[model samples]
Target: MWQNLDYVSERRADTVMVLSGDHIYKMDYRPLLAYHQEKEADVTIAVMNVPVEETHRFGILTVNRQGRVVEFTEKPKERDKGTLANMGIYAFRAGVLHECLPRYAQQYSDLDFGHHVIPTMIAEGYRLYAYRFDGYWVDVGTIQAYWETSMALLDPDSPLQLYDRAWVVHTRSYERPPAKLGPQARVARSMICNGCIVRGRVERSVLGPGVYVSPGAVVRESVVMNDTWVGPGAVLDRVIVDKQVVVGAGVQLGCGNDVGVPNTTYGDHLRTGITVVGKAAHIPPNIRIGRNVVVHPHVDEEDFVSYGDEVPSGETI
Candidate 1:
C-alpha cells in the first residue's frame, strides 16, 4: 500500500495514519494520533498484547521502558517474553513516509510495511514509538478466524460490541423486511439477518439477508450468506456457504469429523479445514459433500454427479 502513498504525500499532510482494513477492530484513532504527536515520533506503531501461542501469525515487537520500539520481527517462529504484536496500524510523519516509501519501493521486491518498511525505518534510526492498545482486535485472515469472529459477535460478553449506539459500525442499509421463521422452525444461538425465510432448524449459525432455508433442513455452526437457497432435508454443519448458492434436497456438507488438513484448491486459506461452497455454485440434489471439501464458484451439476454419491474429503471441485 506504500505505492499508493503518493496521494497522501502530495496533500502535504502533517501526519499520515495507516490502518489495515482486513482486521476486526473497534478503535478511536484520535488518541493514537495524540500519543504520536505527544512523543513527536517519526513513526508510531500500534501494538497489542496477544497470546503467546498466536505469535507466529503476527509481527512481534520488543520495546524499551520508554515505549521506543527496539526490535521487530514478522511472523517469528519463536517468541520471547515480548507478547506485544503489531496491530498493523501506524502513524507516520508525512515527510518521513514520503521519503522512505519511495526508496523502499525502488530497492525491495517485497514492500510490506510490517516485513520491510518498518524494519528499514528502524535500521535507519528513526524515532519510532509503540502505542499500546488494550482493546479487542482480531485479524480475520483465514476461514476459521472469520467463523470464530462471526460467532463471537453473538456472545453477550464479546469484546467487540455492536449494540452500543455511541460507537456504531455502519454498513450499507438494505430495504428488506424482517426475517421470517416458520411455525415449526427452531433457531437458537444464531443471528438471522433481514429478509431470511427459515422453515428449518438453525442453530449456532449466521444467515445473511434473503436466505431461504426449506423445511426439514438443518444448519448448525455454519455461515450462510445472502440470497442462498437450501432445499428440503439438507444438512449443513461447520460449513460456509457464500452468497447466492443452491443446496439441493437431501444434500449434506461438512461431515463434522474434519481432521483439519490444509488445502488451497478453493483459492482461500482455511484454518479448521471446514467445507466451503463458493458463491453462485449449484449443488445437485441428494449429493453428499464430505468435510473440508470445496465446491468452487459457478461449478455445474456434472461436477458433483460425476463423483457418484459423495464428494470425498479434502477434495476441491
Candidate 2:
C-alpha cells in the first residue's frame, strides 16, 4: 500500500487524505479536512474514544488539551484509561507525507502508517494533531469485530444509524425484488436484505442479498452473506457464512462451546473466535460444525466429510 502511495504522492498537490476501508462508520470528511487546515498540522489523525479494555486492539493516542498528539501506541499490551484511538484515517500536508513516506520506505522494508509512519513522524518533532470524533466507528478487521458490528446495526438505538436520510449510504443498485417470507417463517430483530427468501426461523441474524433460508431451518446470532443457501432443517448459531455457500439439509454449525485454540494450518483471518464458513464452500447434509471452526473457501463435501459428521470445537476444515 505504501508503494502505491509513493506513486500517488508524486502526482498529488497540497494535501492528501488516507482512509482504511476495513472500518464501519459514517463520516463527512469535509469537516475533517477543514479542521486539518485550521490546525495547520503536518498530519491530522482522526481519533475516537473506545473502552479501555478494547484499546489493546487499536492504535491508541494521548492528546494534549490543544489537540496535539503527545504519545502514540499501536495495539498496546497494557490499557490506558481515557485514551483516544487512531481511526486509521488521516489528512496530511502532502509535502510532509512525501518527506516521511519515502524516507521510511528507504530506511525499512516495513511500511504501514500505524506501525511505522505515524510514530516515526512524532519522534521527529512533526506537528501531529488529533481530530476528535465522537461518532460511531468500528474496525471490522477481525471476524469477531465484524460479527458484533453487523449485529449492532440491528439495534434500534444504535449509534450507527443507517436510516438517517441526511446521511444515506449509497450502494450499487440491485434490481431484485424485496425479501420474501414464507407463512411459517419466524424472524425477530433481524435485517434481511433484498432478494432474500426466508421460510424458517431467523433470530438476531443478518442476511445479505439473495440468501435463502429453507423451511424448518434455524439461524440465530449469525451473519449470512450474499447468495447463500441454507438447506431445510439446518441450524446456524453464532456463525458467519460467506458468499455463495451451500449449507446442506440438517447441517449444524456453531453448536458447541465457544472455547477455541489456535490452528496454524489456516491464516489468522480464518482463525475467527467464532465459526466461519468461507466463500463458496459446500457442507453436506447432517454435518455438525462446532464453535470456532473454519471451513475454508471452496471446500467440497469430500474435504468437509473427512472430518466426519461432527467437527470438534476449535478444529479448522
Candidate 3:
C-alpha cells in the first residue's frame, strides 16, 4: 500500500481499498466503505466465518463483541484462534495508512498485511476494526482448489451466483465465432465456451473458447483451454490441458488409476490425481499418459517419441 502512496495522493483519494485477485466472489465495496466511516476506523479488515478445520489455511482474527480486531494470526497451524478468517479485503484511511506504513517498512524486510501490518497495528492500539462478510469467497491459489471452484460453477445451487444480473461478473474475452457441435457430438453437464467445435463426447468438462474435439474423441472430467485440438479417438480424463495444444490421434491422456503416485518432479503440488499439460505441449499419437503426470510447457510431439508411447505416472515431461 505504501508503494502506491504517490499515486493515491495524486488522485486525492480518501479511502484506499485493497483486494486479492486469486479469490472469486461478488461484493459491493460501497457498504464496506460506509461501515468503515461509521466506525471511524483506521483500517477495516473484511473477515468471514470459515470452518474450524480450515482455519489453518487463513489469517484468523479475534474480534470483540463490538467488532474491533484484537488479534491477528496469519496462516496459523493451530486452530485455537477464532474462525474469523481474513478475506484480504481492506478499506484503509488513506491519511493514516500513508503515515503508518513507511515507518513499518523501515523495520520489516518482508512487509505483508496479514503477517506484519495488521498484527502490529493492533498491538499499537490502532483503530483497526473487523467487517464481517458472509459471502461466497474462495482462494483458488492451488491447482486442486482452482479445479474445485470451476466445478462448483456447475452446481445449480452454488452460492457463487454468476447468473445474478444484479451483480454481474466481467471477464477478459476474445473475439470468436459461435461454438459448433457435430451431429455425432454428445455433451452432458458441461460448459462449452464460444468458438468451440465438438464432434465427440464431452462429459462434466469445461472447454474454453475455440477448443476442437475431433470425431470419436472423449473428454471427461477435464478442463481444456482455448484453441486446443483433441484428435480422433483420444480420451482425456481428470486432466487439465492448456492453451493451443494438440492431442494426437488415439492418444489416451490421464489413463491410469495410480492416483497415489505423486509427480516425480512436483510431489507436493501435483500429487492430487490431476494430470497437468502445460501450455502449447503436444501429445503424440497412440501415446498413454498416466495420472499425476506433468507435460511441461512447449513440449512437442518429438519429445513424446522419447517416452516410447507411454508416459508413466509421476513423471514430468
* Steric clash pairs (candidate 3): none
What are the per-residue Cα lDDT tens digits for candidate 1 across 166-192? 999999968999999999799999899
Query: Least lDDT summed over 10 consecutive residues: which range in candidate 1?
Result: 262-271
TM-score computed on alpha carbons, candidate 2: 0.90
Q: Against the hidden reference, what TM-scores do the models get?
A: 0.94, 0.90, 0.97
Q: Candidate 2, which ten residues in sequence have the lowest lDDT sum?
A: 258-267
- lDDT (0 to 1) per candidate: 0.88, 0.87, 0.91
What are the candidates' C-alpha RMSDs?
1.9, 2.5, 1.1
Per-candidate clashes, comma-separated? 0, 0, 0
After the best TM-score superposition of candidate 2, give how far the Cα of residue 132 lies from its true spot, in angstroms: 0.3
Name the regions of candidate 3 deviating beyond 4 angstroms. none
After TM-score superposition, what is the CA distance of residue 151 in candidate 1 from its true location, in Å?
1.7
Please, what are the lDDT tens digits per residue for candidate 3 over residues 1-317? Answer: 77877888897888999999778989898889999999999999999999999999899999898999988999889878899999999999998788878989999888889888999999989998999898888888888887788778777777898889999888898998999999999998888899999999999899999999999999998999999999999999989999999999999999988988999999988888899999999888899999999999999888877789799999999
Summarize candidate 2's per-residue lDDT along 1-317 as a digit string, tens digits: 45676677677668888998778899999899999999999999999988888888889988888998878999898875356889999999888866788799887797888989888999999999999899888778777788989999889897898889999989996788899999989999999999999999999999999999999999999999999999999999989999999999999988865545544455465455578899999999999888778888999999975677888767777
In angstroms, how far off is 45's CA in candidate 1?
0.5
Off by over 4 Å in 1: 256-273
